[model samples]
Target: MLHLRVIAPAELRNPILNVLQREPGVTHIVLHPNAAVEPAGDEITADIAREAANDVVERLKSLDVQNLGAITLEVLDTVLSSAAYHAEDAADGDAADAVVWDELVARTRDESQLNVTFLLFLCIACLLAAVGVLTDSPVTVVGAMVVGPEFGPLAALAVALVRRRMSLARRASAALLIGFPVAMAVTAGATLGFEALGWVELTSTRELHGVDFIFQVGPFSFVVALLAGAAGMLSLVSAKSAALVGVFISVTTVPAAGFAVVAATMGDWDIAAQSVAQLAVNLVGITIAGVLVLAVYRRLQTAKESGGRRSAGV
Candidate 1:
């Protein structure tokens, strides 16, 4: 179940209340008239079934409630009401299957931005992966994967394409373009510094071949990328952070970028080229897969809403 807190304009308060009252699986409606000091309106609260949440939010958005007021949603850990039980049972679909695009849009918008924290994590992840490659440590590579922030912009790109938001697409692209190259450049300098300090011994890369295969372009690479991308999109929309971490571990973008950086700085052009190709394959593969997954999910949502509207008419 989800709980909503709405602060609505004075004129829209009654209409908003009516909308909540009329919606199924929405219960425990409360209103405090003339309570909003800043907005000078009313404060309202409602409990909505998780399955009905997307619809309720959409309805409120259509009424322009978000434009004139604020709507906040919180997951309910415990609901004591018998009405809540029946409402949960009465919901039409599984809660986990709901996409809630508006919520997704808000989330990705914040994540896709080119911010200081984003660049910091990207650069750090790159350096860590570079260390992993130089030392041939799979553990270090996995740690770097978990640290990399590239997935946000990647997922943002997918969401932008699905939503056809050119501005967001450009922003996400800009983040990737700026973030990846900058990260590689920084790691390259770090690699040169490590070489001068005699901290790393550049080897044949054969010892790490089992793990280094991730830094090669192949059918297996594309297949893993596709699976990771799809799972990533699901994890993002569902707010499943653990699943997202798993997605990070399964992709090769960060590792390939770092490997390419170290190899190029060390004048190993063949390995550098191969790793760069691997990076490209992973990025493009995952992006295309993410776009497809989001598109399909969005279409299913549209269909479900359409079906609901038709059922209402009938």
Candidate 2:
């Protein structure tokens, strides 16, 4: 369930109420007239079923509540009311399967920010992967995979493509296009710095067994990336954060980038090239799979809403 709060000007309050009252998935409606001092509008609040949240939010947006006033949706961790239960029961679908698109777009938009912290995380993750590559440590490589922040932009890119939001698409694209190269360059510099300091030594013919797979590209690499992408998006939409850890572990994007830089530093151009290929394969696979998943979900949602409207003679 979701707790929805709205502030609307006097003139539009009635229409907003009409919309909420008409929704069977809403309950515990409370109207505090002229309750907003700064905005000088009525404050309306209600409990809404998660399955019906998107439709209600869109309706409210059409009334210009977001600009003229405000609309806030928060997930309800605990709802003990019978009315809330009834509202959930009245909704069209299961809460677990619900996709609140506004929430998704907002989340991915924030996650795709190109800021100092993002760069730091990326550089650190790549460095860890590089260390893992040098020492042939699978555990370190897995840790690096979990630390990488690339998935956020990748997921945002997929969402932007499906929603046709060019602004968002460009932002997400910039993050990935700029972030990866910058991280790789930093990793190479760091590796060189370490060698200069006599902290570590890397040779072209070094026998690396445990972490060699990071540079080996094959059909299964793409397949695993595809699966990880789908799972990542699902976890985002379904609020299954635990599942995301597995998604992160399954993809070799960060590991490949790390290995590429380390291999190049060692003058192993052949291995570096292979690592680059692996990185490309994983990124493309995840993106393609994410786009397909969101596209299919959007289609199904449109069909379901259209059917509902037709049945209601709307």
Candidate 3:
């Protein structure tokens, strides 16, 4: 299903070719010898000739070819048999690489930066939720839920815990810890500013009791968080990323945090405490669920690998 292109030194070419040939999903191997000048002895290139791109990548990693010079295995969806022979041909690079775990981590780290877009998105979401709470509009609340960008780092945290990558875990945790506080502070400032401009009257609403929606944690709150976390993780690993937006909408984190800020601004300490409790409950529940789901996914992958090895008598 995959097309492998190997450009190695005259001596190492045979060994590398033998490895590729033995790989289960790899076929249509093309060898390029005496290709170019380089510091390393050999240059290896591969493309995904099979639909089992993940399997092929894992097999390549098992060969431990990093010490070799500039080994590039570009996983291609379409077969380019003749193109492998044409070393100088230009092609679109995006289609050449498959989505691997490390690449996913790198992409997530890049996307989760505390940039202006992230701040704006969180701020706007919280503001909308505050307005929703004031007007008692469930539609606006759902809008706020969809606008929150809290899932990026949470998903990253889950992946880190599954892989036992402590650095990633710490980074993700720091992002969450800092991001929430920052979002809340901004929301509070905005609330105060609105009050000064006479744009928001906190006392005029009869539905101050409706603020209980933001606070008032219960077993169902934890259940929702747990399910959201599992769905978020699944959305990350599966190709169904569109479903993640819906997952974001289904949770109340942004709305709760925003409501808590509004409660604090109105000098409602009791509601503020309740909102904080709600936030804590959701966060803990999601983290626990995400970790559990990732652990199971990793276990299943490991079991599959072990079974394959046993079948091959390795």
Q: What is the lDDT of every predicted structure here?
A: 0.85, 0.91, 0.68
Give the range of the ten consecutive residues with the poorest summed lDDT in model 2: 199-208
Going through the candidates in order, what is the number of backbone clashes in each?
Answer: 0, 0, 8
Is 2 or 3 the stronger prediction by TM-score? 2
> Where does model 2 exceed 4 Å of error?
none
Candidate 2 per-residue lDDT over residues 122-238, each given as its tens digit:
999999999888778999999999999998999999999998988888988888888989999999999899889998887852598898888889899999999999999998999
lDDT of 1 by residue, 285-311 (tens): 889988999889878878887998899
lDDT tens digits by residue: candidate 3, 47-132: 54323455545555555544444445443444546644332132212222223465456656765666677778888888888888
Q: Provide the lowest-lDDT 10-residue window in model 3.
A: 87-96
Listed in order, each prediction's TM-score against the native is: 0.93, 0.97, 0.78
| Candidate 1 least-lDDT 10 residues | 202-211
Q: What C-alpha lDDT does candidate 3 achieve relative to the native structure?
A: 0.68
lDDT, ranked from best to worst: 2, 1, 3
lDDT of 3 at 96: 24
